[model samples]
Every structure is written in structure tokens, then in C-alpha cells.
Target: MIDAIKTFLVKIKDQGHVLPLIHQADIQVNLHCDQQIIQLNIKNGGILFLQNLDGQQVKYEISGSPTAMKQLFEGTERLRVLEQQGQLKASTPLRTTLLLESIFFLTKAQNS
Candidate 1:
């Protein structure tokens, strides 16, 4: 899953759209699925995926149940809608939240 996500991000980045959406901000974000957390660290126009928290500071964290997470990853349910309905919890400023949402939405692997 992590390798797939890395590939997805790389593909998205190579397509030339992801970086502009980020607008050159270095950020660390987390997506929590059940008891697992996947960290996305964006720095110097590159992205890294980490499966452990390791106490690193996270700029944003979005969490949901495993089913809800599947929905998000599959694009069956949008993050904004889930967040609005309290199906998912997020910690970050609205701008950052939106950024994270867009990033996730764009990098979702097909048939994932």
C-alpha cells in the first residue's frame, strides 16, 4: 500500500499538477486508518511516505475508520463531505486541510 502510494505520488508529481497545488510549502501530514497511521512528508518539492509516527511533528492529521478510509482512498466518499458529516476527524488550519484533501484526492491510485 505504501509503495503504491509512493508510486501514485510520483506519477502525479511527474504529471506537473501536484507541485503547483502545494504552492511550495513544506508539510508533514498523516492519514490514520484504524490503528495504522501513514505519514506523508513533503519537502523540497518531493514526497516521502512513512508508516510510523515516531513522534515527528505533523502539520495535519486526518483519521477515520478502516471502511471510511477505504471509501476515501477509492474516491467513493469525498474528504470534505466526510469531514463535514463528522465521519472523519482532521487537525489543521482550513487552508492546510484543503491542501491535504486535494493532495490525497489527486494521488489516489486507480482501483485502490
Candidate 2:
């Protein structure tokens, strides 16, 4: 599951537009899927999987069931839709949420 998330992030990182957005972003994000928690450190246009933050600050957190997370990674479901349906929760402001949504949307578009 973490591998899949890393793959998705890599795809986003490879995008021309995403490089600029992420290059300036030094963010720690946690993806909570049921009892499992995966931490991602996004910095300098790269993503790193962390076993633990080691007291590092987290900028965002997203929680959802495994199924919902899978759907999101597969681009079969939109983040906003899942959040609206109460299937997922994202702890971020609207601007950041939209930025995430756009990044995912752009990756999906590139694949298509």
C-alpha cells in the first residue's frame, strides 16, 4: 500500500507543473488507513517514505479506509467526492486541498 502511494507521488513529481509546486513545499503528510499509518515527507520535488517523523512537524494528514485510499490512488475516486461522502478526511485548508486535488487530477490526465 505504501508502495502504491509512493508510485502515485512519483508520478506527480515527474510532472512538469508539479515540480514547481513541490519544489517550494517542505511538507510532512500522514496517510492513515485504518490501523496503518504511512508518513510521507515531500520536499524539493521528491517524496520520501518515513517510518516515523521523529518529532518532526506534520503539515497535513489524510485518513480513510483502505478501500477509499486505494480508489484515490487508482484515480477512480476524487478526493473531494470522498471527503464529501464522509469516506475520507483531510486536515488541510481549502487552498491546500484544492492543490492536492489538482495534482491528482493532473496525474490522471497525464495517464489518459
Candidate 3:
């Protein structure tokens, strides 16, 4: 999982280098497994660069405290409960719900 995150970050950095035309930013995602709290703190240093519509290259940084992380995990746990039932029946509804809940986190990270 850590490797995957590193790979994703590297890929995004490479994209920023290639484009040099879109707003890019980075934040340190401090994930506390014990508390299940995800704190995203924008750092003093980041690699993302941007060139806006006027063709002005600019630096970018992203800072956010998106509080929906806990809610997202709770929704997933609800679905997990159903999956833990004796009858292991997999259906589209279950899959869709998981997908949607996952989007809440993914989109939050991407947009931030």
C-alpha cells in the first residue's frame, strides 16, 4: 500500500513536469490508523507547477481539512457489515455503494 502511494505521487509529479500548464499542488496526508483520522497538511515545499490561461507559470500549494473522512469510512463499514452476513451474496447495489463511498475519499484527495 505504501509502495502504491509512492508510485502514485511519482506519477503525478511526472505529469506536472510534462504538462507545466495545469495547477498542481501537494499536501502531506497524515493518516492516523489508531484514531482513523486523515489530516492533510499542506507543506512548505511541493513539486507541483502550473501555467495558467494567461501563460504565466505559477507555483501551487493545497491545504485542506476535509472533515468527511470519518463519514466515508463509516459508510464503508456499514456495507462491510452486510458483507459479513452469513449469506455472502454479492450484488450490484453492494458494489455500487462501495464505489460511491470510495469516490468520496478519492475525489476529495484529487480535488484538494
lDDT, candidate 2, 1-112, per-residue tens: 6756766866765678756666766767788886777786767777677764455567798899887787677567788999999999999888777766666666653255
Using lDDT as the yardstick, the better of models 1 and 3 is 1
lDDT on C-alpha atoms for all candidate structures: 0.71, 0.73, 0.32
Candidate numbers, best TM-score first, in rank order: 2, 1, 3
In model 3, the clashing pairs are: none
Task: Write down the worst ten-residue block by lDDT for model 3.
Answer: 57-66
Give per-residue CA lDDT, model 3, range 1-112, as digits (tens).
2332344345444443333322232333333322233332323334322222343322321111223223232232232333354211223344444543343333232322
Least lDDT summed over 10 consecutive residues: which range in candidate 1?
A: 1-10
**Cand. 2 Cα-lDDT:** 0.73
Off by over 4 Å in 1: 1-7, 74-76
lDDT of 2 at 1: 62
Comparison by TM-score, 1 against 2, better one: 2
Clashing pairs in 1: none
